[model samples]
Every structure is written in structure tokens, then in C-alpha cells.
Target: MHAWMSEASLDRADNRRKVPEWVSAQWRRPGARLLLVDSDGQVATDETGSGPAGVPTSGNYNAQLHTFLGLVDGIPWFTTEGPIIGPSASLRHLGAVTGGAALELTVGAVALTAWHRLEPHCSGCGARTRATAGGLTRRCPVCGRVQFPRTDPAVIVAVIDPDDRILLGRQSSWDPGRMSVLAGFVDAGESLEQAVHREVFEESGVRLREVRYFGSQPWPFPRSLMVGFVADSVSAELTIDRDEIEEAAWFTRADLAADLAEGRVIMPGKASIAHRLITAWQGRLLG
Candidate 1:
């Protein structure tokens, strides 16, 4: 599993939060570290360094450079619009090479940055918003309304038939032969299990039962919280919705191995929860 999929050593005390100035003071403490992410979502990492590399600098905050991410092991960790001191790497690569420290900061920063970029005004009053709560929130000066970072909850389910075959689907827009589990966003008043059932039925004309949670991951490519599940297939029919899915099919472990070797099917990247779910059901990791 990707380390970044899980939480890190940081303690995000959102309930008993510190003020901005207090958070900044942690930067001056010895052994403090700074991390940064580009506008495109890559973490600033040294190409030659081992294990979640980060930029090296004294603990000083540059207003335009750093966004206070949170406390890492009780010390300040910041992200920046960096002219990073060194080369940078993608979060996917970082996951294979490192632990949660760098990955957590990068993901949090990217989420924060996305919110700031996408929301600049209060929805309630059209007032300009400013960073508050140690960069964890945005406040409207006039209405005093506060906005925090938001993650859209989406359910990604690995559906299985009584025969134990796994169901996978491919979107029309995906790369050739790429396949993944069925997924959809939770609707206005629906539960996660309801979304799973509805999405599966709508996309493939299949019904599912026993919707059980598997795990979750932070997929912050423009901010989404991927809630994972495993569901037993009640209907084996394959009726692909042309609007959403181009293809839907069932595969056994042996079939997956053959397709993987022949390059007939491309699995999800290791950085994604889909990959872990697939490997888990197969009773082994893909080599």
C-alpha cells in the first residue's frame, strides 16, 4: 500500500488549533523542516536523495513562499510555491521511494492550494476571503463566514460475483485497455453504500449486495476522498452505460495474470487505492 494513503506523524489538532503566529513560531525551533508542492501537484524532492526528500533551509517563513501545512511530529511543516532548492518529483514516485512525512505535507498543501485557487470569494455574501486559522481556513471579512478545505466523497467499489470473479470497467476517456473498479460520487442525500449500489446499477446494469467498507485514500487530484468498498454481485449482467463506461467485464485471478503479461489490460497505478484493492482480491500483489 502507498504510505501516503494513510495518515502521517503529524497531529492536525483542528479542534484545538493554534493561531497563525503560534504556528509560525514552530518554524524557528531546531530540526524544523519545510516542504513544498508546485501548482501542478508535485512535491519538491531532491532527485538523488533517499526516502521522501525535502528542501533544506532554515526555519523561516516567506509569506509568498510558504503555506503552513501543519505540525509534523510537533514541529511546523510548510509548503510553498517554491523555487525549491533542488529538483522535484511526483507524488506517485515519492510514494514508492518514501514514507508519509513528505507525502502528507505535499497532499495537504495541494488540497489547500486548490481550495484557495478555486474559491476566492464568499458564496454567501460575495465578499473577498482571506486565510485564517493558520492557513487551514478562509474567512469572509464582511459575512464572517469561514470555509475550510473540502474533499468530495466518492465511492470506489470492487464488485465480486459468487464465483469470486472481480468486476472492472473502463471509461471511454481512459487510456487504451486501462481498467478499474466502479465508482461514483455520493449524491445530495445518498449514503456511501447507496452510491455504490446506484453507480453499479446505473453504469453496468448490475446489482450489488453486502456493501462493506474496505478502506479509504486521499485522492487530491483537484480534491477527492476515495471511499473504497467490496460488494457481492447479485446480478452478473453486463450492461455498460455508454455515457459513463465503455466496457465492463468480470475477471478471475488467472485471467488478470494473463492479460497483465500480454499487456491486454493496464491496471491502476500503485499510488491509487484501486491497485491495492485489485491486488488484495487476487490474494497476492502483482509482480
Candidate 2:
């Protein structure tokens, strides 16, 4: 399972968030904590660099700069943007070292911070929006339209052939040794299964049959939800789409293991759904 899907430790308290008094009370409660995130989606980490460097939610914090991040163990948690005096790390690195609620909280904090930062205006009308409902929503005064956080859906799949070989591809922008499973964003008026077939064929000319849902991951790299799937390929053919994929190929388990051991190929990191999907197919973690 993805790191963000850990056992629940934070209660979002969606119903109570509607009450301004309650949200304010959560902010002022003892043990209230604040997490700081930069525009690049990196958060300040503790001295150990294993967890977020959270400070007390004190002083007169501007409501626009911070939002409620739910509760951990009945203690309120808030997220804000600001400068800090310590080491900072991206969710990619943090996801590797942290797990459970700590990782979940950090992911939530980063996603919320990015949403509030990028979406401060109304999409319907050209009007500025104000943070409301403890930062879960924004309300435009001119149009009176409320906007919720946006999450774009994308699909990532592992294509297995009749011979039990998995297909992987390398994007042109990546290093020579880097490769991973095929993935693309879902289009309008399209279903998840359609997306898997289209993306696979477009990238590698591999027709798919019997596509099955695997799982999902909250890929908050600028707010995206990655839906994972596994599909059987009709045939193994090399038809690389140089536009997005620089090269494509099918590899058996033995070939993949040898390439990985010899430093000839690099798989996705543990932080991504692609990594999890590939690991599941490979029957073990990739080196």
C-alpha cells in the first residue's frame, strides 16, 4: 500500500470544521502544532531529518497563511508557509524514511499548503478568494462561489506479457539507467480502464487485455492522485513513442534482476506508486 494510506491517526473533523468557533478553539488549544512548507513542496524537518520540524502554533498567525491539518491523538495540527531555521526535505525523501501517521501528516501538510498557495483565486470569476472552513475551502466574495482543493487523477500501470515479462519505459528527460512503469493522466470523458489501454498503446504500442485495479497513491507532486493497475499485454512489440518515452522494452524477471544488480537499469523510488506496482510484480523490492 502507498505510504499515505497508513492506519488513521489524524481525524479530519470535517463536520466541526464548519463552525468558526470550533476551528478557532482548535488553533488555541494546548499542544497545537504548526508545520511550515516552502513553495517548492519541501517541509522543514527536525534535527534528525526523519520527521517534520513542527513549532508551536503561537503568535498572531494570519488566517490566510495557515490552515487546520486535523488532529493527531486529539492534539490539533496546523500548516503554514514561512521561513525556518533548520534542514528541509521534499516529500520524496520524507516518504522514504517516515511511515504511519507521521508520513500521512507530512503528506497532508504539503498538499494543503500547495493548494492554498496556488489556488487563492476563483476559477469561475476573476475574483480573489479568502480562506474559509479552516483552509479546506476558499470563497470568492464577488461570485460567492466556494472552491475545494483540487486533485487531478492519473493512471499508472504495469504491463505483463504472456511470458510473464513486465514492460517498462524510460522518459527522455531521465538518466540513462532510470526506467519505470508507464503512466499518464486521465482524459476528459474517459474511464480508468480506457486510460490504461491508451497510455500503454501510445507509449509502447502494446495492446492490453484484462486490466485490473491494483491500488492508489496520493501523489501530491502538485496535487495528483495516482491510480495503479496491472494489465496483460496482447503481444510484446517495440514501438517507442519518442515524444514522451525515449526507449521501451519488455524484461523477464531474470533479466530485470540481472540489469538491476549490474547497475544497467534503475527502478522507481520507494516513494512512488510505480515502485510499489513494480515491486509487487517483481515479487520483491528492486535494488
Candidate models: Cα lDDT each? 0.76, 0.86
Best by TM-score: 2
What tens digits encode model 2's per-residue C-alpha lDDT throughout 1-287?
Answer: 33444457788889998777898888888899998888788898998888877788887645677798898889888998767668988899888788766777788988998898888889999799999888999999999999999999999999998888899999999999898999999999999999999999999989987898887888788899999888998888768889979998888889999999999999898888888888888894321
TM-score, one value per model: 0.90, 0.95
Give the worst 10-residue stretch by lDDT in candidate 2. 1-10
The prediction achieving the highest lDDT against the true structure is 2
Off by over 4 Å in 1: 3-7, 15-17, 49-52, 56-65, 83-85, 284-287
Candidate 1 clash pair list: none
